[model samples]
Target: MEIALVGAGAAAVGLLDALATTSLARVRPGLITVFEPSPHLWRGRPYGPDLDTVLVNAPPAIMSIRHGDPGHYAAWLGESGAAHLDDLLGQPLVPRHRYGDYLAATAEAALRTLRANGWRTRIARARVTGVERRGDRLAVVAADGGRYAADQVALCVGGGEPRDLYSLAAAPGYVHEPYPLARTLAPIPADARVAVLGSGLTAVDVVVSLAARGHTGPITMLSRSGLLPHVWQRPSGHRPAHVTAERVATAHREHGTVPLGHLIGLLRAELAEAGEDFDAFAADLLAAGTEDPVRRLRRQLRSVGDPRIGRRVLQETAHTVGPYAWRLLPESGRARLRRHFRLATSVASPMVPVNAATLLRLLDAGRLTLVPDVRAVEATGGGFAVTAGDSAIHVDAVVNAVNPPPQAVPRAAGELVASLVSGGLAAFHPAGGVVPADPRVQVAGDLAGGGPFITSGIPGIAAQAARTADAMLTLARDESSEAPATLR
Candidate 1:
């Protein structure tokens, strides 16, 4: 048997690690081929070698690629010493490129394990164009006219690039994507008056990176909501009492679906169990949406050591039980969440205390500004005119930091998915990702839909990888058992 994984990034790394560690791999040691055109195989677009200021957003406990093992990444960090301690968060927030190093090492280690178990493995540094069903097997077509046959395939493509909302890709001094800050930041003049689109984590990255690179001119973060991400508190290690994956699954099994109110009630119960006030906490979170951005950042930085575990509990369970609850939510419930999507995302994907300090400093110094209700950004004579809430501001450079919508297909993978859907080999999920029309072809990352409306973090991606590996192996085993003796 052969398994093909397309788009060798973080998801592919997780899948490969899963395949190597699972018991089923020993029973069915097959050839595994990974297809990725990028020179950085396991880093994906997010983790590729970049500026030192481009750091991992989350803590090590939640960044582990091995499912159920929260310490996997932290242990790796301790052994390698590739990370620096974020004293405020009380955890190591390594550079993105350093995290990429961990991924590459993990993939290499997983490949070694597979090889030791008699499973042949190779990475095809080529982009996959399409997947065609050939009888019971799959033919993975590559961009270089190379084709590989596999009994199973996993599409582990990552999320899409930042959206170019204002059609500024062709505009002078406009950066459509703010990644690999090392490259993107170099072209902009140090004193350029830069306007960064969106007020999310990516925008924070840009502002902080600019300061690190000695950028002195004014920087403005323009967005529709103008709500920056909540700052990460030192984790309280709070365990949920009522809000958990098992409870969510049980509720889904008992009731036809999980209502939004029911999920909120579970959260309330969890907070109550911790002797915390749900209403106060809820009101505080709500106030964040309308509160002054600089004031909020300053307040959050002061509360990094707060003893309250309400946010910590919610953050922990968001990935663990959130996915299960999302699937069980009625369309109305999902819509309601979508209505407050910006706020929810800001809470879920918070910034580290270190970067938050940088932002607060910039805001206090009047070097940075937050513009809300961004209407349009048009290229003007020598700069761009950004219209926000009835006010127009011009800047020399505009940086697109708008994150892609949840489950968005990357440009490179969109064609492959279209081919699969057109050929009836796969079906696209309305929520997101490609649903497997043929179970042999699975999905393992942000591209795999039917979940929450956010990109899967490392822990979530790891969980998906584990499930995909287990499902594919179980299917293979069942088929092998039912096969005729002559074929065996």
Candidate 2:
């Protein structure tokens, strides 16, 4: 096929898996090129191997790279000499790097199998600087002046560059990149107060990392809603009694791309069927002040099951239709979703049990504070001045813990997309990033607008890769059929 898979991250892993197992190979010749300059294969920066207090919000149960093999990572943990920790495998969240270990191991094993099965695969230890159409093929040009010709290019560039919370590029004590190869936080004095922007899981990771490293000084996490992420409980696989895939399909058939509000109504109905409601949950999520809404939510989680059960049902429903739903929506519906998506997703991506426990412990000890949101950040004589809703605080360091905004445009990817779009091989989605003009050029990953399905996590990536590959294979079939017959 002479396929070029750019960006060997989780999305690439998904594509590799698809190529390795699917019958699509019957339609094309076999030669795959992977471009990644990272030291290791599949562990993208987020999953890079490192010893840190940061933990993946998802549990080991759902961490497998293989689509149908849910227990792949759990089994790998037992076989990879970490069997002693098997007791915690069922529900506890493990270190983030363990996922890197799983991914790298999975990639190595899969690549070996592919080679043994008579498939040729090559790795390019460089970055794909840009993609330009050269005659009949797309040229994946590397920064090292290397160019690879491909019948098709699958752009799996992961999430784009992070959006900075403040313009503190030159400000002292401002920790812009919280997750770094080396910890810049160790230099901060133990007694120095800090302000953390955003109260999502990213903020939780930063706070947990600081608290574990003996940073006893106060930390105030500021976010727009002042709501912390929901707590994870044991997962329930049973379909929510009310909100099922059939219901979503039915809603779509009736409403023609269900509005975000009506989808919320469906979710509320599911919760009600499950003997729960979103009244309290909504109150906490919509709360606009320094009060910790998650505190009340956590108490409820301890008493009842995780609030994410209803969310899981709705998320599963979204899996069936969300990718096209976003595009199908009226401008008003899109606006509503864009306005509240983060707040809604915060509850969907829950914090691990231990993270919630650690956060509450810090809060109880008065070392952590959750504020409404950061209004502004400015440089002060000592460090940075952060203004929350009503109070102003100056801290020794300001850590921006906000994750990339939804549908963020990749900083470096802009050039590549521009090249492709200018060449009429791709289209940029106004909601977010680039979309492939033809199935020959595929875009897969967290920046989901370019493909048929949108997703960020491992499962979504795997499915998106498979879908993109299948679509590409279909296009390849057409291309092959149309090629002129020749005798050489």
TM-score of each: 0.98, 0.88
The list of candidate 1 runs beyond 4 A from truth reads 79-83, 486-488
* Model 1, CA-based lDDT: 0.88
Candidate 1 TM-score, C-alpha based: 0.98
Assess the local accuracy of residue 122 in candidate 1 as a C-alpha lDDT between 0 and 100: 89
lDDT of all predictions, in order shown? Answer: 0.88, 0.70
Prediction 2 global C-alpha lDDT: 0.70
Clashing pairs in 1: none
lDDT of 1 at 151: 92
Q: What's the alpha carbon RMSD for model 2? A: 3.4
Off by over 4 Å in 2: 79-90, 240-256, 259-291, 304-308, 315-321, 450-455, 481-488
Poorest 10 consecutive residues by lDDT, candidate 2 = 81-90
